[model samples]
Target: MRQKATSLFAVLLLLAAGVAPVGAVVGTGVEASAVQSNCSFPVTATDATGTEVTVEQKPENVVTLGPSEAQTMWEIGGKSQVVGLTKYASYLDGSDSRTNVSGAGRSYVNVEKVVAEDPGIVLAANIVSNETVQKLRDAGLTVYKFEKAKSLEDIYAKTTLVGELTGNCEGASETLSWMKDRISTVRSAVEGSDAPRVFVSQGAGWTAGENTFINRMVELAGGNNVAVEANVSGYGKISEEVIVAQNPEWIVQLGAFGAYPKTDAYNGTDAVKNGRVMTVSNQNVSQPAPRVVYAIVKMAEAFHPDAFAAANATTTASETTTTQPTESTTESAPETTTEGAMEGDSTETTTDAEDSTGGTPGFGVPVALAALAGAAMLARRR
Candidate 1:
């Protein structure tokens, strides 16, 4: 099972590579008929397991097991097609009305409930047990799975894949272009600023390191990840000694504002003494999707106040003094569970990151929505 899961992950990596060979959506024998070559039929995509999955028809009813998948589907104009979603996916705007197939607490799917939905397509994440995916396939359901994206590039790839599956490739392309533009704006805003040494505290002990999108976002926001600099990779605990030795200038917490209040470990740190510790919404700062740019902007504002201040002042002045009008437009979790052993006999478990390799799936639409809300709050403050 583990080996099969690994193969699935490799295929997702290939999908994240942005392109793959096309194949026909085969008749898996549950209830699906043979696919015919048409606009919707004969759609082919590779799953995380390296199996080529072809949809005989464009899915009229879709079930998304990951919040990120739901959000991406919505962003790509496929919301009307979503008929089912995971319980946690309720965080999305329209998901509350969708049928909740997976149960609460655990990240595993309820195979019986899923089959009852009789969905044309089931979108899932790597955190879903391979057994569950196999069972769905056995039942003649088309299941499309993806591993959590680890970077902006991965997010684009995933978005593109969703677009292709939903027959919304144009929407996906436009979304990708919008994300790039937003990122470029942020980069230009923070250009030439000295990058701050930063620590991303997901919880009391968990911190983001290399090979994770959080680390990438921090860099894009003009800050250096202290955890990555410590040679830590993925999600891991950072020792107090390391924290003390490398006193970060900024601390970005995943939870509420008071989550990481002043403590012995932070007493002398620049972030603590200067009161620079910021609590970004976990949904936005954590999720790896288009809305991630909002978090990046928030981070940039926090990390280099001077840059934003200058930019804001310039904008304000230009708006107030010049006779110019501008047009503006705006738009737009997880598939896996992981069980980890904590300190005691009782096992501590975490879902995959919005895409979780550690505590919970950190990437999804709710995270993005929360990030957008955070951006709004920051905007109001300005």
Candidate 2:
């Protein structure tokens, strides 16, 4: 039965891939699709992993449910649309784009907050409850349901979708093409060579489960992950006995706020003694931010230290010290987003930075509606 179940799971994964190839939408809404062909055939794209995204026209106010999606949207130049974010996104650098309208986890998001944001479309994670989806629809908000994007392909497709929704499809296509070329280059570099034996430990917990995005990163970065020994779940913290037995040559600590110090953290382990361990920023390595390709390169450096010896321009100590954004992030978290209204922290308001492209910032038609509302109230008083 176990063998049969595993077979079924594999079959489903393949089936999912076939129907939802990396580039274009099949049998779904055409304009609603997150990914589109890049002006020609034989296009390479980030294969989406069962994310049902329906973006209408150009969404002005966008809300993201998961940390990965939140980070991705911001990286593809969609930060202005983000009116909602989970608490975890706050941990990564610039991950906390929106204020704390929602809770840290699932509890942070409420219908009232979503309504206050008045978002034209809400980009939510796949695991949300049926009731929540219905509630958003009932409130007249378009919900774009996306599964957790797990692979590099997932990242590309999601970024492309963001571009399409933001009227920046051209930018997205160019970016993805550039990324694909980089992936090819990196793959070629690692081909036919013995990569490092790597063990990636989630900073807060043990190892990752099966089929995680992290596992895919392992495959891409050309390292063998130790956590594959877990059961059908795909991720589980291995026992210390198991870890000691394998004695992986490399240990990677994944954390949101840059890399956490593992000197004392992983003592009594071979990874610590041999100094084969590295702490990488989860925001860089995991989140859907624009720097993901850079993250892959960083991981590649960790796996095959020789190939990427020149990659370490900035040491971890300097990065951690200078880029520590605790105060700004925390200060911005409660009052800077539409979520601030939901969190009861919406008081003063400020303008966003002008488009670096030097054009007028697009604030959507809802801002026009707000102006009309204020004008109507004043006219009635007069």
Candidate 3:
């Protein structure tokens, strides 16, 4: 239960700026301070909405209202403290013990069940309305609402905030360090490599555009996002004609299912004829948590196999040959920047909103990443 408020700012600042492994050091000033402040109570923290919340004691029972928050809590070593979560919490392998207590989409919250749990702290995202937050506050409950994170910096800030609240600032620092290292690793691997024109599909015609984590992920992995190139911002749908017009070299579908059923739709495109279409797990890509690193690496390998040849290369020449790039190497694709998208003005059409309560059953991650994801699913069953 160590909560060092002193090093909190410094650690968070490093993470928000993005991780560079060149001269990074962990657990010196900030981490040591966190370790020294174990079990500290009456701590004050500010939420993403500029609200200051003071916790008189360590929260033994916690409730997370969103998948991203739940995943963040687990990363900061507070998973065992979570007592309740939404039905979508099932995405994490060991979430069976946590009961589903969310509303239908992202608006309503089951206030009755939330109060019954007697949680010391209740976590929520921006999608949760102000009225609902007031209801919980009126009941004398502690609630912290996180604004919708549009960038990696926002995610790091939110993660650090949770660490401060849960008295796991040390864990938070460690997790952020891990994330920075992973991101740095991927970036270095793909440096100076060609950025292939890639279409990121989340099934049902929805795709991630600017102001979204997925968009940033593509840029970090050295893949040109065709949706962003088409001026599509935020999660929106583009017509089939637009897809044909763009003619992406690679199609990286985010969910369990592919947006395009057969190659007929992409008959002449590079993704179909060249077999460069890939399916990634929704849980890894959708949740803005530590698992995002997995998504970055997955897309990097797909977009630039040659960039990762050294690490992926095996002693056997035959297996090495298999890892070679099959698709045409994109030489001069557009370089992506972290441009924020307009909120609520997106024209993209999505089958379902994946705010906090949505779930795609058939989505699956690679076996290696899946094992790491499961191990991160720390639980504290009431």
Local accuracy of candidate 1 as per-residue lDDT tens digits, 201-308: 754445768866667788999999999889987666678889898899998875441144356987788888998877654335433445556677788888888887
The candidate that achieves the highest lDDT relative to the unseen native structure: 1
User: What TM-score number comes out for model 2?
Assistant: 0.61
What's model 2's lDDT at 319?
31
Ten contiguous residues minimizing lDDT sum, candidate 2: 340-349
Question: Cα RMSD (Å) per model?
Answer: 12.1, 16.7, 14.5
Q: What is the lDDT of residue 171 in candidate 3?
A: 75
TM-score of 3: 0.69
Q: For residue 55, give model 2's deviation from the true position in Å.
A: 5.1
* Residues 1-382, model 2: lDDT tens digits: 5544333322221111110111232223333224454322222222122334445457667777545556556555567777776554564456454655553211435667877888867765433444555678789877765433435665676666656655556556555655665566567556666866567664323455456556666668777776664341343445655666566677776532112234443465666688776665444553443555665666676676664443333232223221112112121221122211111111011111111111111111222233233333334554
Per-candidate local distance difference test: 0.58, 0.47, 0.56
Worst 10 residues of 1 by lDDT: 338-347
Clashes of 3: 6
What is the alpha-carbon RMSD of candidate 2 to the true structure? Answer: 16.7
Mark the regions of model 3 whose C-alpha exceeds 4 Å error after superposition: 1-39, 104-107, 261-263, 309-382
Tell me model 3's lDDT, rounded to 2 decimals: 0.56
Give per-residue CA lDDT, model 3, range 1-382, as digits (tens): 1223222321221111111101111111223223332446776766534567778888999998766678778777888999987644555546778766754322235888888888999887444555566688899899886555555665666666677677777677777766665566577668888788888765446566765666778899899998898898755666677778889899886443324534455667788889998866544554555556667778887787776655444322322111111221111110110000111111111222233221111111221122222222211110
